[model samples]
Target: MTRTPQCPGCGREDRLQAVPAVYLGGRDTVRVRVRNPDDHHDRTVDRPVTTALSEALAPVPEPPSRAIGCLGVLALLVAVGTFAAGAGAGHWLDDVPVVEGGGVFDENGIFHAPGQELPTAGPAWPDFAWLAVISALALTAAVLVLVLRIRSRRAFTRLTSGRAQAERLWSRAWYCHRCGTVHFRDAPGEDTRPLTFQEFRERVWQEGGYGDLAATQRALGGVLSIRPGQ
Candidate 1:
């Protein structure tokens, strides 16, 4: 039997126990300890606790994680396809202005419609039209993909580490070692730039509405290092 310490949180004696059951550490970290001031043998662990217990404590899940793979893949593919199409359209096709309506051209050089302007078949129409469509679709897809990848990576890190208040925000975000925030195996744009602690604290204070004055100041000092001069 391992001798446990009482929770400083609830002042219950004996390893993870409290005179009265209370939440502590992770979920199971604050286990159920029956306190019998009269008895020396009483204790219990109620639930099957795991690491996720601590992760749930984060203020927000943060970015990118809320998104993931397949969608990112599809967007990348579209961007490639659209860019190819745009290139083909812009460079290969010859613009032959035929007409500008949806009337049926009966194979002959004659147009058949009361007042509808005929859509003239241009030489480069096939190449240019397809290219343009592809390019537009592809670019949009690519942008979406890039954004999602960035976000998912960030989220995954947050999920794993449920970072503490004192930890350098920039340190965590840049070296998100757990989720591999910076390491890219020969992938494009793998170079990660981490914000300094000061920058991080400033950004958080200004952007995120964390209204804790002590926390805000601590973040600025710890993360940003606001030593009097530099």
Candidate 2:
């Protein structure tokens, strides 16, 4: 069974109901559904986002991948550069043995003194090689953080209409909530995609639900007027 978890954003006992799953594409938010207790009205409506604090708690969508790709490239370049610095320090700065093994004590090879090991150890590499590695990695981290911040900012604007969609939704849901009056103009959108009552609650509530859950309870109260507690 699709049991609902209380919304972490709102701290309500309501859960995700099937039939009409919430649609979350317009503003790049991970939107979800909320509903009245045990009420199953098969109508969908958009809700304004009321609780700024609660809305802040909702999941933000991922930033565009191009920004992420650039960050990865920066990280890879840093890794390669650091590795090269270490390799160069070890190979060029340090002295390797001239002879493969103790062949002969001659000009072509270095003669080891009595009771000595082959390929004698040399001076340790400079500490500056390690500093190069650290510096490169730090630059990569800074670049990635900047890109993420920019992308997230752009995504935030998409949730609210650019004044156009709002005009449309307002034109559509143009009925008095206090009374059971209907709108003069027909809701423009087609019933193209039929949603369950639970899904309907989630989609419309994305905008308006957080302001006052009590207001929602009141709006729904009319539908559920028969029940004593409703």
Candidate 3:
């Protein structure tokens, strides 16, 4: 026979329920009436207790790989634009004839050439070549950013592998409605002071190895620490 769960705070077995069960039981549904049957809707409402439990048990969000990837993509677009501009300028410059002094005069009468002796006021072939080189460097940087993003995503996946075990631990937690405290079923009898929701959740996650994972992520730095709200 299964023994009834007793609340550590009130020493009563009558009002104790599993945390997950309490959360589920505290939810209410409201049906909205509409003229059309297809437009009818049912909305789930969570009681205050249920909302608190849900927030406490919510999963840690993944690292901001998507935002980093967007930066990589923006860099790639800039590289492409610069490359196209450089190539177009080079092609246009190739058609222009060099004057007798190895320099060409622009419509504004500014002279440009490959050497230091000539005036460098107008666009020239060498300028476009340097632009192409800069574009190539930018492209390389963008590629590196994208690769790092992929690696960070993979690392986050590996780090969160123990989340299921943490959730299992959470499922076994008990809530005392009378005193508003939570505790695990196997909690020590001597340490019967019930934990707050946050404390309970943290203990569960720590026992499930998620605490180390969080620490490791923090050590890794960069986008790993980029969680929402902080």
Who wins the TM-score comparison? 3
**Model 2 misplaced stretches (Cα beyond 4 Å):** 1-69, 92-117, 120-124, 135-185, 188-230
Arrange candidates, best TM-score first. 3, 1, 2
Worst 10 residues of 1 by lDDT: 175-184
- Scored against the true structure, residue 189 in model 2 reaches a CA lDDT of 49
- Evaluate all candidate structures by whole-model CA lDDT and list the values in order: 0.41, 0.40, 0.63
Of the candidates numbered 1 and 3, which has the greater TM-score value? 3
Superposed model 3: Cα runs more than 4 Å off? 1-55, 59-61, 92-124, 174-181, 186-193, 213-230
- Clash pairs of candidate 3? none
Q: How many residue pairs clash in model 1?
A: 23
lDDT by residue for model 2 (93-167), tens: 454554444454645467666444445444445555674666567566757666765766565455433334333
> Which tens-of-lDDT digit does each residue in 1-230 have in candidate 1?
94443222233322222201211244454468775667877877565462332232222332344245566577667767766666665554444334446655656667666555444444444555765676567667667777767776865564435334323231223212122111112223322343333333443333333423224343221222222112
Higher-TM-score candidate of 1 and 2? 1
Candidate 1 lDDT (Cα, whole model)? Answer: 0.41
Name the Cα RMSD for model 3. Answer: 11.7
Candidate 3 Cα deviation (angstroms), residue 69: 1.5
Candidate 3 or 1, higher lDDT: 3
